[model samples]
Target: MGYYAKELEALLRAGRFRRPIMADPEKLDMASNDYLGLAYKRKLLRRAFERVAAYPWHAPKSSLFLGGYHPIHRDFEEALKEANGFAAATLFGSGFLANLGLIEALVRRGDTLFIDESYHASGMVATKLVRGEVVLFAHNDPRDLLEKLADHPTKGRRILAVEGVYSMEGDRLKREFFEIAEWFDMVMVVDEAHSNGVLGPNLLGVFDHYGITPAPRHIKMGTLGKAYGSYGAYVMGSEETIAFLNNRAKSQIYATAPSLLDVALAHEGFDYVAKKRKKLRKKIAKLQKCGVSCGYPEPEGLIVPVPMPGIEEAVACREALAREGFEVGAIRPPTVARPMLRVILRTPLEARHYRELFAHISEWRDGV
Candidate 1:
């Protein structure tokens, strides 16, 4: 304890000390990543439970390589591949693990990984474990990416990573990124955690939204926790790429298979999204309108970030909203470059609630 005391004190002084608090179900949720509100739907839960109960093994007892790959997992993978127009798909314990496994397994020595600077931290951390060269381009700037590519040439494969709807800024990936990847012959990895089930005509994710036919080099990784409202993740790519990951990705080979219940629930979530996409899109558009009316830029997705002056002010604003029976995320340094209130415009929240939230945010921004 004494050895870590100084570091702890420093964090406290910076107003970045962290602790998890119990979620109050009674409060109106405006912070969590359950974009489609599938987490609160009892019908989905009931269906998932029924499905799980019918299976002989409700839990994965071993790694997927060791016979833990159940029919449920395979079915979900198949569904994902079909919906997203990928040749194959594989499941992972979570989005972080998927990203970690992908970067670690795909980028070998002599290879180069050109990633967006604003990509998720998990992918950033994975770079340290790989033997490849990494180059970061300006966030969402394709010109910077092209410049970096011109500056660095590699003998081996080139991989590009970007997010569909960045978590912090809530901005969609630029269309030019896909074109660049194709022109440069790079393997493009799109993290669709925030966009899947929330965007596109089919709500399959960014690929669907952009109407881009996935090439052999295109890879898509998406989480079930956000819009899907479950847990676990899936990666979709060409059949050969997925097979290579199965053989080389230690994270998937060493860890136990994902929970059967979660996968089943996510499958139900996929169906739910398909059935309700039209209504969900309308809800999202309404929230985006409200945000724009309140002086915020129109959100590319469901996340609406309200910037705060500083860390202390961000915390204070969160507490004030909590007192008013609203629960929102007060994001600070390390997670975001600046302090902000992350408001998730979840579909479960009514239009009136959004209006109220925007009003409060406008007041706070104006120092009313």
Candidate 2:
């Protein structure tokens, strides 16, 4: 315990130690990634349960390739493919697994993987396991990416990975990235964990928002846990790409299949988002307006990051907000370079709650 004790002490001294706490449901939530507020929808849950109850097996009970792929999974995958305009789709246990499988399988020897510096940690970790050269471009900078691409030439495939919405920064992927990928003929991987069901006129994702048709080289990965309010992930691409992943993606081939109930619930969530898109957009707009009125920049999606001077100030702000019955995230290093209060402008939170939350944040900023 001596070595572990020293590491724990160091974390405490730097004010970066963390521990999960049970959520206080009594408080107004502004912290979670449930952007659509579908997690708390009783009707949705009941419907999902009804659908799953009809199935003989509650869980997949094995890897997707080995007698585990159920009709529920197939149904959801088909729906996702149709919605996102992809020729094929596949499911994974989570976004982390999806990234691991995608990168590990797609990036072979001689391939080059170009990624956004601010991309999710899962994808960054996946790069370490791949048998390809990994190069990171400046966050959301197309010029940097173009320059980097020219500097690093590969005899094999050039893969580009980026997030639709940067989780902590809450900024949308630059539109120029799509053009750059097309020009370079790179296989583009768009992780839409935060942007799916939030951005785009159809509430599908960035491609839908930009009105770009899915090409054979385009791979879109999205988590069902965030906006969909379920706990799994799915990847969509061309038929050949999906077939290749099915054969080579170790995570999908070895890990237990994604939960049947969660997939069912996510299917319902997808339907709900499609049916109530106009209403959901209004809720998002209302929160964005409130954020601007409170002196914050216009949020590209649901996340609104309130910058903090330091770790202590960030923690103090979180505690102060909690005292006022509002729960928000006090994000600190090494998740971010600096500390900040990560606010999720969830649809479930009322307009009055947004006003109060923004007022509190404004006061905190003023004092800081």
Candidate 3:
């Protein structure tokens, strides 16, 4: 216990302590996951919330297996399932819980789990709880994943996990990843937290980005928080897959279901995104013109990672930018493999905002 305490102290001393900050209306906000900016639109959000205003505050306080489950949840699940072409769908409290519950239930002691090296922290945590063989492949590299599969060559239950749109790097998955998983007869689990409302004709996710139909063997976990600007997540898969998780996924079975208001907001948010996608894309295109260039892969979504090279330099750049009234994401080790500025774009941002951001990055890069 003392050893862990000391380690935490060291992290704090090194400016790596994790702390939360309440959202400030006056701040030039850029550090949020509100890709679509619906959360910031008061009138829109209020109107959406009004649809469920009749529901009581403490309506959904019980776990799904208990009294928490509601007809609204079932209706939302069915709607999302039909829209996304899944055999069945189940909702959870959040993206983290969705990934934790689904992944833990799928990968057991006798199974093999292959995850992307750059997978989200929540998914990584879920992997730790699995009593199975866990292998990490190079980020977004299908060839390396193929090599790993060849090395393991498991005929038993196997899972290949990836993110549809990488949260930190903003990279998108290619069709090749799906092909590789299918070739090996492995279950493909895609966490589309960042990509859910940013991709597809109707924001259906990665399959829309790639212009392909969803494979039956694919298990998709998507969040309502990021682009959807709501407070829950959902897992879509075959009826059998969903049924198994409903019975076995500990997080979902034990955790309280989302409130009726939250579910209502998510349903409305989905419709909002679908209606405003074209306009949102225009805003994204404008924001993409901001900031300094990086060597990372081109973004397939709204996240724009501006590289700062090292921890000290990244911290300095973030601070300097903050002083200019822009609250950009100051990313560092542990959350990512290396230090870089995580700049998430929103549909409400203007060209002037990006121009200021670009100016700051130029100043930092020039060391002036």
Candidate 4:
């Protein structure tokens, strides 16, 4: 505990925590997941705000499982499912809970859980909790999963787990991964937390872009916090799986449903993305021109992950950029392999901001 405290203090001294600042409406901000620049748009804000402002305050008097599931929840679920081509979707409070709930619904004690070695920590914990015999394949390496599957005990069942886009490093899922999932008849769970509103020509996620429909063997978990710029997550699957999760998953059954206002905002956010994804993609492309190394520079969507070596180097670069009136995000693991810097490229940050950021990087003292 002492050692952990000392390490946290080290991070604090470097300004890495850096106040996780709220967006200044007047400032040019890139620190948020508002990739489409929709979160701040007054038009959409007014629409959602109006709905929330009108919500009957008396609704909160009811218990979550009773009559507390608001009309907006159903509306958001329908719209989200329609937008993403899912047969059905169930909302959860956040990505971590969604991932955990999905796993618990799918895996049992006798099952074999094979996960991407670097998959999100939440998915890993979910798989572990059920005491499923676990096998891990190298990141994006489907052949390794196939080989492991050959020997794993089918006395139970198998689930293949991986992220659609690795959140930390900005890497993408290799197409071949789905083939392994298909071949093994393994339940494939794809967490599109980072990729949902960013991938494909339609922002329909990688699976939909590839023309693969997620079936019983395929599950999609998407978060509202990232590209959606809102506050929750949803799992997409067949009606049966959703029903099972709602009944048996501890995270879902125990937690109060999310706020009506949050669901309203989520609906507005997704609607905005559906209409303006092309514009967002173009802006992301222009940003790639200036940064020396942006993870997936041409980006498969709205996220631009800029990598900087050394923890101190990343920290200093972030502070320097922040002081310059730019709000770029600095990410150090437990998110990435080592420490890397990230910049969320909102549509508000035009080509000129990218230029300034690149210029700042050139002489920036990367404190090591």
Q: Largest lDDT belongs to which candidate?
A: 2
- lDDT for model 2, please: 0.92
Candidate 2 local lDDT, 28-146, one digit each (tens): 98999999889999899999999889988788888888899999999999999998889999999999999999998999999999999999998888899999899999999999999
Per-residue lDDT of 243-293 in model 3, one digit per residue for the tens? 999998998998888777777777877777777878776666666655434
Q: Model 4 lDDT vs. the true structure?
A: 0.74
**RMSD of every prediction:** 1.1, 1.1, 2.4, 3.3
| Count of residue pairs whose backbone atoms collide, per candidate | 0, 0, 0, 0
Q: Which stretches of candidate 3 lie over 4 Å from their true place?
A: 1-5, 55-58, 290-298
Model 3 clashing-pair count:
0
lDDT of 2 at 324: 94
For 1-368, candidate 4 gives per-residue lDDT tens digits of 78588877876775445454566655568677666666667777678878777765623334346666777888889997787667888888888988887786678878888889888888877876776687888888877877888767678778888988886656778888888878767778898887777677777678866777666777788888777667888888778877777787777778878767677887888888778879866665676464545223455445567767767787778778777887777777656766766766566677777767766766674433
The estimated TM-scores of all candidates read: 0.98, 0.98, 0.92, 0.87
User: What is the model-wide C-alpha lDDT for candidate 1?
Assistant: 0.91
Please say which candidate is ahead in TM-score: 2 or 3.
Answer: 2
